[model samples]
Target: MDAIVLLRDGLAAALTPGNLLWAFCGVLLGTAVGVLPGMGSAMAVALLLPVTFQMDPTSAFILFAGVYYGGMFGGATTSILLNTPGQASSIATTYEGHRMALGGRAPQALGTAVIGSFVASIIGTLVVALFAPTMVDFALKFGPGEYFALTVFSFVAVAAVVSGSVLRGVASLLIGLAIGLVGIDGQSGAPRFDFGSPVLLDGIDIVIVTVGLLALGEVLHVAARGRNAPDLASIRAGKPWLKRRDVRRSLPAWLRGTALGTAFGPIPGSGAEIPTFLSLGAERRLAKRREQRGGGESEFGKGAIEGVAGPEAANNGSAAGSLVPLLGLGLPTSATAAIMLAAFQQYGLQPGPVLFERNGDLVWTLLASLLIGSVLLLVINLPFAPLWARLLKLPKPYLYAGITLFSVLAVYAINASVVHLVMLIGVALLAFVMRHFGVPVAPALIGVVLGPIAESELRRALAASAGDLSILVDSGISLTLYALVLIAAFIPLVSRVRRLRAERRERETTGAGTS
Candidate 1:
């Protein structure tokens, strides 16, 4: 009931002429940013932070949200047409979407993607709206042990699952932890890694690390690899409307994607891209069973409709799912989510516990706006998806140059520090090295961002308990959390051993039968 009242009031505010205009403009700008490759919402938002200083916080936030969602929406275009995901999240879409384009069904492919995303976004928004407050209460009671356990769990799950390799993920996380350690020690009042620089005493800024690793690193990586081809064209289908059967086949897939996304959305350290792939894999397994039973043949690699539908649904739903932790526990799992958390901080807003009581209006308003945005995406995109794609056709020199300039300006504006600019360049070089070694970047990032906070909690808990480690065992919840972490850490190796044993047995059985 309280949520309902809040929602009603929020809807009224968001729908006002001024706010609506802001929303539209945000969506447009966000879409444009999305059309450009490697230009993620975090980069877009970070770059715009300077201009935002003078703007109303509400309107600026609305624009940021629009850019965030719009970038996501635009990412699919390149994936569907060119098999190049504009951002990381659209990677799965390209698997089947590119095939659809080759088959001259680009229009349908685009339609399904847009529609699926819109639906999922709405579901995600609702999940945020309904569960955030309750979850915050649950998170607030957590002690240091629990926090540490959760942090470890996040590192393992995201690193092992999100990154290509568990070893590399752990390595990257450790690096982040090291970087995180480079500030004044909260407990001893002594600098650990400042190296006598006064600027280092306060610790590295999250904004600095985020922009350096994500934006500037991306630019440097592309530049180092030789100039990217200019004037690449995207799929230019005539329309973006789906066929009748698309709706029938996709509805089920969307539901499945939504389920997967919602289940994983609340978990920390997860990103939007993984859910899409997971959904695609789930659909394939299910589709294989249906084909086997019904005498249907596989159409998986050939633009199977289910491939498009399931991933699309999961991606959108997970986007919605992501809001759960952000709004509830104040944990920003993805890079984009992290930036959003930063935005909240800039406004002096904390996401957990009292957010509902203090900023219920803003929360509800955002939620209501999400519902509207989803609908608008459906209507706007189904017809205009190509116009969005045409952005890729623009001259390459201008595009890349613009992106580079924006990257520089955005970073410079954040601090106006030449030292930070050099730092950004150095990080970009490191990112390039990591890429070459196939090390996942996100874990390193998650580590750097979460390390300090996790350390703080651990130290606080230890001090509170007079350095007695037994307090880690005091709470049932904390004990359970640690247990889960232990299991997660070892589960992969256990599974692999079991799998290899089973395979060996199968081979032995086949040989015996031949004899």
Candidate 2:
């Protein structure tokens, strides 16, 4: 009942004309960025962060929520129409989605993707609203040791599980940690990496780092690709309208994908990509089983509406699900969520249990705004998906130039500092190098956001226990988190070993045949 009352109040606040306008603008901008290859919600939000510095926090968050959900909706458009996934999470959608488009069922594939995204977003946001408080209640029990353990788990999971190469992921994370260490030591007010520069003492601003790494770095990387960039000249998106039979086939898949996404979303390091792939695999298996049972013919390789529906739903659901941890535990599970965390810090707000107590209305209002964003996403994206795809029609050089302009302006906007601009260039160069080396940047961003927090908690824990190392695992909660960390770290190595062995066996079999 209390939750209901709060939601109602939030609805009232979110319904304000100003907030609604921001939501509309955010979704529009988010969809545009998502339609463009290599640009995601994280980059959009990071670029916009400086613009929102003076705006009301509530309104800024509403805009961000809209952009976050809108990116999910827009990613499927390119995947279905062009076989090019705008975001990593949309990679699963491309398998059946492009095939569907090739089979002249592009409209049905797109329709299912949009509607499935809608269904998943609505259900997923509701789950967050209902369960976020409970998560906060659970988080209230966390001491410094437990928090440190949680950070450790996040670090290992992101560095080990998210990256294809664990070594590269760890390297990226160390780079971020090193960047985070540039400021003064919070514990003793001692400078660590200032190098006798006044600007260095203030530390690298999150805004500069995000804009440089995401927006500017992406531009540089894309520019380096030059003529090799993915061509969008052959893109075609017809009207996306589903037949009754298509709807019937997609509904169940939508539900199933939503369930999987919601289940895995809150787990740190498990991004939308995991749930989306799982949904794809599940849909593939279900179709096979249905065929075997004489229920229907399986469309495993061909364009299946179920395939597009399930993965798209899972993508959006997981996107929404990531918010649960971000809102309740102050943990960011995805790149966008990590940037959102930086936004929270910019507003002098922390997104944990204390947030609900101190700014309960803002929290509820943000949740309500997310609901509004989801609905707006459906309304705007359903009919305009093709138009969004045409965003690729814009010349690449011009698009990159604009991004470069914004990157510089966004950094310059931060207290109008030239030193920050230099730092942005350095970070952008670093980001390009990381991208060139195939290192995952998300883990690095996560390390930048969480490294200081983890250090502070660990230091506090040690201080409390008089430098005893065992204090880090004294509590059941802390021990459980560390245990999960070990499991998370170990699983990747095991998988790698299996993969290598399978490759070796394949080589031997191929050699025998050749001989």
Candidate 3:
């Protein structure tokens, strides 16, 4: 009953005239950012962080939540229409969504993505409302050693699961760890990687690294590749309209995707990518099984509606899922969530065990606002699909130039330091190299955000135990987390070995037949 009253109060706060206007503006801005290639909610939220300093924390957070949901929806628009995902989460959407566009069923693809996202978003929001406090309670039981173990689990899971090559992901994460080593040492007040430079003592700002790597790096890479005309002319249909068949196929897939997303959301190091890919793989297998049984034909590769529907739903669902850790444990699983963490720090807020007790109104109001934002996204996205497609019509040179310009400007505006500008360019170059070599970028961002936390916890645990390393593995939670890390790490290697063996057998069989 008390929970019900708090929820009602939160809803009332979110629906106020001023708050509603902020939600609308945030949705608009976030959608626009999502429609642009390589621009993401992280950048949007980071940019707004300095700007929203004077506003009420609740209102600023409401705006950020709106942007977060809007960006998820908007990225789907670009994926369906142009075969180009505006954000990493939308990558799976492009596999079949673009094919649907090419087949003159762009409207159908768009409809599935939007509707699936809406359903998943609502379900995810309800999850946050019901489980956040419980999660906070659970988090309070963790010690420094448990926290250290959790970070290891996160590192292994994220690196092994996210990248196509585990070695590359580990390499990227190392780079981030190395970056994290810069600045003054937490315990000794000694600088490790500053190289005698004053600017290095403060450490590289995460905002600079994020914008440089994601936003600027993408632009530089694109410019280097030279522009090609995006083939969006034939895909432009009116508003997204769902057919009966489309509804029949997408409904179950939506539910399955939502389940996968919700399950993975709070796990450290697991983000939207894993859930989206898993949903797509599941849907593909289901379609194949249906074909074998003669119940339906499988469209596994050539414009399957279920492919678009399931992954898009998972993407949005995971977005909501990431919040579970962010709000409940002060752990961020993805790049955008990392930026949100920074925002929390900026507002003098910490998002952990005491957040609910200390800031109940803010926390509940934020949850209510997320629910409100999801509805607003549905209303706003449906009508704007066509207009967003028009964004692709803009000249490539001007668009990329503008993105690069704004990225540099934003970094400079943050600290007014020439050193940051220099660091931004350097990081952009490093990101370009990583992109060229097919390195997954998220683990790097994750490492940068989580590395220091892990370091701090490790040191604390050692100090508490008189430098005994055994304490790091003493607790049940720590042991379980380490065991899970071993499982997460071993599964990928085992799967890879099995796949290679299977492929070798198939090749031998084919060679024998040819001979």
- Provide TM-scores for the models: 0.69, 0.67, 0.74
Model 3, stretches more than 4 Å misplaced? 5-19, 32-68, 71-117, 227-366, 511-515
**Residue range 1-515, candidate 3, lDDT tens digits:** 67667888999999999999888888878888886655668778988999999999999999999899888877777677755466767767876887888776777787788888889998887876777666545545678898788778767766775576889989998988888888999899988899889999999987687667666776677777763534445455666778788889999999999987876677665567667767876787689779879987898678999998899889888888888889878999787899999989999999986888899999889888887887888888777556655554567777667767767776787679999999999998998899889896767866776799899989999999999999998888889989988987887788779889999999999999999
Residue 139, candidate 2: alpha-carbon lDDT: 43
Q: Give Cα distance to truth, residue 462, candidate 1, Å.
A: 2.0
Candidates ranked, most accurate by TM-score first? 3, 1, 2
At residue 203, give the lDDT of candidate 2. 90
Cα-based lDDT for every prediction: 0.71, 0.80, 0.80
Lowest lDDT block of 10, candidate 2: 229-238
Estimate, for each residue in 1-515, the C-alpha lDDT of model 2 and write its tens digit: 68778888998999999999999999889887786555668778998999999999999999998888888877777677655556667767877887877666666677788889889988988887787766445545677888788777767766764466889979988988888898899999999899999889989987677666666777788779888855544445567778788888999999999998876677665578667766776787688679879998998678888889998999988887888888788998788999999999999999987888898898899888888888888898778756654555577777567657755775787689888889988998998998898986766766777788789988999999999999888889888878877887787687679879999999999999999
On TM-score, the candidate that comes out on top is: 3
Model 2 Cα shift for residue 172 (angstroms): 1.4
**In terms of lDDT, which candidate is stronger, 1 or 2?**
2
Hey, what RMSD does candidate 1 come out at? 6.0
Which candidate, 1 or 3, has the higher TM-score?
Answer: 3
Residue 509's C-alpha lDDT in candidate 2? 100
User: How large an RMSD does model 3 have?
Assistant: 5.3
Which residue runs of candidate 1 sit more than 4 Å off their true CA positions? 1-16, 32-117, 127-133, 195-204, 211-366, 391-402, 473-487, 498-515
